[model samples]
Target: MAGLACAGQLAAAGHRPLVLDKGRGIGGRMATRRVEIAGQACGFDHGAQYFTIRDPEFRMALSPLADAIAPWDDGGSEPRFVGRPGMSSLPKAMAEGIDLRQGVEVLALRRDGSAWLLETKGGLVMARHLVMTMPAPQAARLLGRDHPLVPRLDCVRMAPCLTLMAAFPGAAPRPFLHHSSGTDPLAWIAQDSSKPGRHAGLTCWVAQADPDWSAGHLEEAPDSLVRLMLPLLAKTIGAEPEMALHASAHRWRYARVTTPLGTPCLADEDGTLWLGGDWCLGARVEAAWQSGTALAKALTRHLHAG
Candidate 1:
């Protein structure tokens, strides 16, 4: 969300920006997965469930994706929007005709005179300006322990999350579309299939464990997590565990931003190098977008390139 938002505005200003991610697709935490279960294809929004646009500018920015997004009833006090087909749909729409390379990771970053030299598996990518949208810990890894952002990021605490994606055949018990309670080990659960444009014949559910539980079991195997989580889900949804056609687990090491930097962004003295993400503000798709937008505008002003 952060990277795409920045690149979009920068591109519109006549500057070409190249976006790269190690994942197979865009949208970062706004991720979705597809798996074949019992001869049927099922999708799960395993990452961010939905997003709320509190900023008028952010809402206006979503105009292009009005058709792909709709309100999600996540049992929240306020309404939120989710992408149709999957949560990644909105980002996939933003990336249309944009220079984005997936399945690529930056191994290291080095300062080369006035440019930032990025070392990737392919080769070195040098840029006069650089914007890093990764989590604080990952960015600190790339920059090393001596960088100024380390101590500040050390204060910005992020939590791990263990999510379960389970699918059952027709007639699976679904008492509600979504449920969340801070007291439970399974902090939140949603009938993913209840959302629009999903597989109708099957019941798909996504459950996220609380931060404490996720932290305690962060190193456990994915299959083990699934084995432990499915029964809890079955018990909660009034469904039979044996009826599940597909069950899987996804671990997010940096899932939620609990303690943020309390700033919109961080830029080098020259404004050529900027680091921003949801960690800069609060943990939300909106915060990530806001940080990236603010930093991009600052970059354009400092460099005067767009």
Candidate 2:
């Protein structure tokens, strides 16, 4: 979504832009998956549950895509938007006309004279301007010591999150409620099937462990972790989960931003490369869009001056 926003703003200002992602699909953290049980399929958004809008600029940008975005009704004054059909639909909508390439992992970035060379698993993509929307640690790995902009990116930090999803046969005892553990490993739990577009018969649940717990037990077996978590979930939701139709675990290495860089975005020494992400501003969909917009504006001014 951030890359698409940046590309949109740049294209509107008459500059060409391209977006590359290592995953098979767009929407970095706003992810969704299709799990089948007894020939029935369910769509679940296990990565980011919901997003809040705090910036007017981002709200303005999202107005056009409002039809695709909807209110989440999470007991907040500000409305949270989800993709109309699924979570990934919004990012796909933003990337409509842009040059987006998936399954391309960027390996290293180096200066090739006046231009920059982006080496990836596929091949080298050359561009006069580059915008990296990846997390700080992943970006630092690709940057190495060639880019002077690395040090400026120190303010960004991401925590880990372990998400566990399970499916049961019968209806849950009560409606979904967010659960927090005072000092336990689990931080939050939600009922996935309770959300929109879920199967009526199947009960779905999502559990996210706190940062400290996730870090400590990062290497634990999936079954063991699930066994340890089911009781807590049962206690919180007031029902014991039955047949485990769709059970899986997802580990988010860069789950959420702890402290933002405070800057809207970052640019290279030569003013030809830019960096933007949720961590650059705040960790949310709106912040991601804001960072991208800010980077696009900065790039526009830099290109015009040159």
Candidate 3:
């Protein structure tokens, strides 16, 4: 969300900003997992379930993507929105005119006089300005402990998440669209098939563990996690685990931000290296967009001034 937002704005400004991502697709945590079961194609939004439109800029920015976005009405106090078809649709749409290269991971980063040199999987690439939108912990590891920016990221704390994606026959009981509990191990569960624009051939559910439970079982194997989480989900939805057509688990090491940096972004004294993400503000898609937009605006202003 942050990377694409930053790159999209920079591209609109007529600056050819390049975005490199290690994942096979865009939308880091706002992801969708697609699968085929019994000749039925289904998808689960295993990452960000839904996003809110609190920021005016974010709401206006989504106007152009109104077709791809939909109101989710999760029965919450406030209105919520989600991307049509899947959560990744929003970022995929935002990346249309931008230069985004997937499956390219940066192994290391260094400053070469006026440019930033990046050692990637393919080869070394240089850039006049660098913007890192990865998780703070990951950015710290990549920049090393000796870097001056590493300490600033120390105040940012992110939590892990363990999610379960399961599917049953279409005849399965339809309990609720969404459920959340503060004490339950299965913190949040949603009837993903109930979302707009989803395939109706199967009943799909997405369950996410709370931060405390996720942290405790972060290192457990995926299959073992399925064994543990599936039963909880089945009990909640009044279904049997044996009736599941497909079941799987996904782990997000840095899923939610517990403590934020209290700033939109971090930058070097020379205005060359900038770091920002959802951790810069809070644990929301709007926050990531804000951080990325702020970084891009600051970087653009610095470049023009130089």
Which candidate model has the greater lDDT, 1 or 2?
Answer: 1
Model 1, position 60: C-alpha lDDT score: 91
**By the lDDT metric, which is better: model 2 or model 3?**
3
| Cα lDDT tens digits for candidate 1, 182-260 | 6679988888888777889888999999999999999999999998999999998887888888999999999999999
Instruction: Give the TM-scores of the predictions, in the order they appear.
Output: 0.95, 0.92, 0.97
Return the TM-score for candidate 3, rounded to 2 decimals. Answer: 0.97
Clashing pairs in 2: none
Q: How accurate is candidate 2 locally (lDDT)?
A: 0.79
Model 3: how far is 68 from its true place, Å? 1.4
Candidate 2 residue spans exceeding 4 A from truth: 221-224
Q: List the residue pairs that clash in candidate 3.
A: none
Regarding TM-score, does 1 or 3 come out ahead?
Answer: 3
| Residues 278-306, model 2: lDDT tens digits | 88877787788888898888889998998
Q: Candidate 2 vs. truth: CA RMSD?
A: 2.0
Off by over 4 Å in 3: 171-175, 178-182
Model 1, position 261, has a per-residue lDDT of: 95
